[model samples]
Target: MFQKILCIILFCTSFTYAQEHLIVIGGGKRPADALNKLIELSGKEQGEILIIPWASGEQEVGFESIKKDISALSPIKVVSAPFAPLTAESKIVLLNQLKTAKGVFFTGGDQVRIMKVLEDETIFKAMHERYHHNVVFSGTSAGTAIMSEKMITGNGKLDVIDGTQVETKKGLGLLPNVIVDQHFIKRQRENRLMGLILQYPTLLGIGIDENTAVYVQNNKSAEVLGESQVLIFDAEQSKEAMKLYFLKKGDKFDLVKKKKIKI
Candidate 1:
């Protein structure tokens, strides 16, 4: 009976990890197919998606537009959680809403804005709790930056990579052992991403191009999607200069093993 109980407990832990789903998109034209996939993973037509537009400067207008776009996906409900002054009543309301949400979507703008508003909130903790079970999470651009614990701030333009040129801050911690960079190829952000990875070799770097995305499942594997490519940098695998790999749509990769797979 003791052995059986231990086996059951381990199985349950693995099951919970397998249920975690995340979609990180590069900023540009929103990919309709990827959005639909997110909805499908979030319980499809019956899903209730919570949109957090805290990252955008124009909160009200930004959230309104986000709601309209998500609604077009035919989900049962799409709710917006604006970046507002939090109060006891407000926190309660937000937490209540989050409880029933099948998915949470973060919009694009300044990553710092989202961090400042929701970092320490009870609602953030609530979302993290739901995430482990089955709640699907999606974010774009600056919203994408917040998915990792060490988020890259899109500051200081440079054509060449050097560790000192980039800046980073604590992120939402949704994706561990990783740092994400958005608007990659279009903005010539290779150096920026390289700088961060070189400075911190322990962490893996994922650079996403505009109109492209990486759909990560269970934090173990990720697949490339959308119009462009997703770049993966593994400093540990390098012998001399840092090496990088580019994955296009339909390509699957093992996040933990750090290798491309047939999927």
Candidate 2:
């Protein structure tokens, strides 16, 4: 009887520890409902939730506003992270909090700011560890962009003569060799995404639109949710185009199959 009880206790403990999930929201206005859903999936309804609003111009305003907005979701507790003038001590505090957080939310702002803070090894390790243990890591807008390996930073203007351009950078690589772009369809970001794909055909380009999300599981499969579509551009099999002009919007590239299909 004691052996059976011990086995049951161990099983319960293991089950409780295996519930991590990532909710990546595309940039735009806001996504309150999606945020709540992510919280629900995290499994700990009454634990600490860390909100990082480092990406906005008025970091304080962004953080406070998000706090108020998220209040409706009624997270057990919400803590704001230090934004401007980042300090090592403050970052360590944030990392410590993240180590046992029920869920972490990255507010929309500037991806650059988010990148700067996440570059720290301690914070990165804590995040990766928590995520591996099934703690939810959620981000929106610029927050969403840095979740992947190759991050797209510039606006997707796509006109060199007109001076409109898009820039790409090395991302946190938390998601591995994946390039993530936000405000996808609303900004017609496919052109820039395709450009990146043409250069590195083996990499996966994920274009997430406003109010939508893609939940990646164990870094292998992802499921799309929300009002918009997640455009996945896979170029592993594309024969190098002589001029690279044949590719157009609405073109489909199968990530799993590594082939192109008409959208």
Candidate 3:
């Protein structure tokens, strides 16, 4: 019953933000189709791309990699600005740049670093607005983990499924009700995701394997991409009712209904 109401709420939110979309990569090599989809949904010709590389140690290289990759596919304008030493003038410039951006990409490094850089309420609100109205947000690895409201900090005891063994922090909050984990299969992250979902039953835990992605459209439905799998953990009713779902490349999932869809 509670899960059903959450679904209805999700529908209403998506209806309001009709153009929202997400391309969450699970680290490793990104498939060509995913990159192309990002370019396509971002308005192939007229859209602007913004890359956030603060999470990366070498921000410039990280920024350039995204710019080059997307630019190679399409001649879209790509730009980025550092959040460090946020000057009033620079902040204004960055905010303005965001205003014209149709796609925003985050590089992988430390999810905590990215979240700390985005601590300003104004910046968060701005991103929240653009993301809902007309933006395609994407990321990989640590970038992938930060998509949810509560992010797994890659800490705590790993051998057990205890609630105390997991540590999480505030993330981008783009998918507040869901917990995202990247490089799932490659790193064998079943324990963390399973532990978290079992601990927090109201939220869903999505573990995306390397070379794979879960493309979410209109804030509701998620479709698998690349030649890997996605694991979903849902425990809405209780820990005893917790269910695990496996999805592959071509599978579609209804975020609201919490089930795999044929169409």
Candidate 4:
């Protein structure tokens, strides 16, 4: 009997824990296929997905818009986290929802605004902890920006490729070792991302174009999905010179290995 209990304990302890998966869209209209994919990964009718719209000026409007889009995709139970400037009482309720959420989405607006409420230590810790334990996180625009640990504020130098000219802040840290940019090709916002990559050579820079998304299911199976292209600034691979990679739909990259998968 003791041997049986010990074997069970060993099996449970040795089981591998899952890592967070990300599906971040650059600022623009999201494709239905992408929404469909999110629904599939989020466990559809089996589990709940939480959406946080603190980034938008009108949180309710933003929340409803995404909830509607997602609901149109499937019968997934979609819940909204209370908008930013959360009170202690409301935060508690939000936290409970977050805990049970199989997936989470952040609506587009100002990345700074989203970070303001998320910066609360307790709230931040809860999110960080859940992400590590495997949650599918999806977002658009500014929501995409908040996925990294060091986030670009989109407020700094626009004309030049100078590291010092860019303004940035600590982000939600869901996707570490990478700085994410939204609305890349459409906005022609390459200078800022290149500059940041030069400044933080150790970090990888991913510029996701409008309507496009880069989904990372662990670091090994990162792939681009949607209509546009995603630019990759891989300074981590070669510190001496930065190489720019333009990826379209169906392209895959190993984020940890910093290599492109030919598929």
Candidate 5:
């Protein structure tokens, strides 16, 4: 009996170490087909998946449906981040869940709220460790914005950006040297994103439209997936001036590419 128990413990430990996956879903409407494709790409069955809906006011609506949709492929364990009445114990629970999860996903909501809750050394360290271990970290919509070093914050309205109005803020710093903006074409956010890029020419501007995603790997090379195109703004090789007032909608900026994409 003692020998059997010891063997069982070892088996569980090895099993836990074998599962490593991450998926980032940008907010907007996630197509059922796209969700399944991501699950398939992760190379893990849905049964091993773990969803972290931290950005949704800590609400469960956005994640619940995703859980249901993905479950068709396999069963997924959905975990909600603590909100409103955050306690030490609740925080620990979230950390512990992440530590053992095969995959971690961020749901869309308010980016500021998500950062306010997770901007700590301990949580940051855990995320770093998990990413280093090859855990898949992904988010949608507001969740996607927080993955960058700088993120746009405020309402998706044109008048929201005139006369001393600033909508960008420091983000989670997960994706170093980049700034992310979401709901691009659907909300006509290109002008605002361009303004941000001009303000910080050193950073790369990545605008993900609705139903689209920029899947970034550990090496920093990313691919755009979904129904929309990802606009990449690189000021490294541009000689044109990026004046805030002179910017126009749908203006194209040239990027210095190491390799041209064939598609």
Candidate 6:
């Protein structure tokens, strides 16, 4: 019995280590510190990083800006992968670019645009495989919203938090058990997030403020970083009303435990 228990423990430990790491940023001006942390996780001094500009209408502008920002941090090579419509040949070519990549970064724009380009493509499959193998995946704004299986379309208004006004679609499904909203505080989007959580109480809600971000590991915890705060709404912990908690820089949250952990 002791030997069997030991084997189970070993398997759990290995599984945790194999899980992907994600850096999700809120919209606005990109925080320098958060970008630096992302680069550090992308193997720093070595390995190449791929930037996907599918979310933006201005692909070249998005590519150059992101490339410049990432290049400013380290000497690592950052290549842009722009998909020209949907084609089998293009999918194979895009997957080939990721063969030697250590990380994948998604720039902000329209989350639906990203889904239209990447969904059911070979490139998406390759990215999912790399994520489990220690490749760092980072996204900002619409990029952050696309990290979850349930993505917010920004179709709702702040006048009220109702299900009828809001809309959600399938995302990348990298982060589980939560719905993420970007530019939370700046945009006064608390109601929208609260509405989603109330409608789907089983899932957690994360409202990330501008100029801030969260470094999420596996499905366990997220460490807050940058100049602002990240609001967490826990439906399971609420009593009669909503349960809300705010986390700032240097703060860490227990995603699965639904509590704050001091770092």
**Clash number for each model:** 0, 2, 0, 0, 8, 0
Sequence-dependent TM-score of model 3: 0.90
The candidate that wins on lDDT is: 4
Can you write out model 4's per-residue Cα lDDT over 158-219, one digit (the tens) per residue? 99988789999999978889999999999989999988898899888999999899988764
Better model by TM-score: candidate 2 vs candidate 3: 3
What value does the lDDT take at residue 41 in candidate 4? Answer: 77
Which pairs, if any, clash in model 2? Answer: 20-134, 55-110
lDDT per prediction?
A: 0.84, 0.70, 0.86, 0.88, 0.62, 0.86
lDDT of 1 by residue, 1-263 (tens): 99999999999987756588999999997687778878888777778888888888787777787677767876558888746665677777778878888988899999988888776667678878888878999988988999999888776657668767778888898999998999999988888888778877877899999999889988999988899999999887553456688899999989888889986
Encode model 2's per-residue lDDT on 46-124: one tens digit a residue. Answer: 7777788888888778778767766777655777876755787787777677776777788877788777877777776
Better of 2 and 6 by lDDT: 6
Better of 2 and 6 by TM-score: 6
Candidate 5 TM-score over all chains jointly: 0.75
- After superposition of all CA atoms, the RMSD between model 4 and the true structure is 2.1
Tens digit of lDDT per residue, candidate 5, span 8-102? 99999866664333233456876454565456544455434556666675367767866776677654554555552457898788788777765
RMSD of 2: 5.9
Model 3 per-residue lDDT tens digits across residues 1-263? 99999999999997876787899999998767788888888888888778888888888988888788787888987888665546778778879988888888888888888888689788888888888887899888888899999999899877887656889999988986899999999999888888888889888899999999999987689999998999999999787768889999999998888988987
Better of 1 and 2 by TM-score: 1
At residue 87, give the lDDT of candidate 6.
75
Q: Estimate each model's TM-score.
A: 0.91, 0.78, 0.90, 0.93, 0.75, 0.91
Model 5 CA deviation exceeding 4 Å by range: 1-25, 31-34, 37-43, 83-85, 155-165, 239-259
Ten contiguous residues with the weakest lDDT in model 6: 234-243
- For model 3 the local lDDT of residue 29 reads 81
Clashing pairs in 6: none
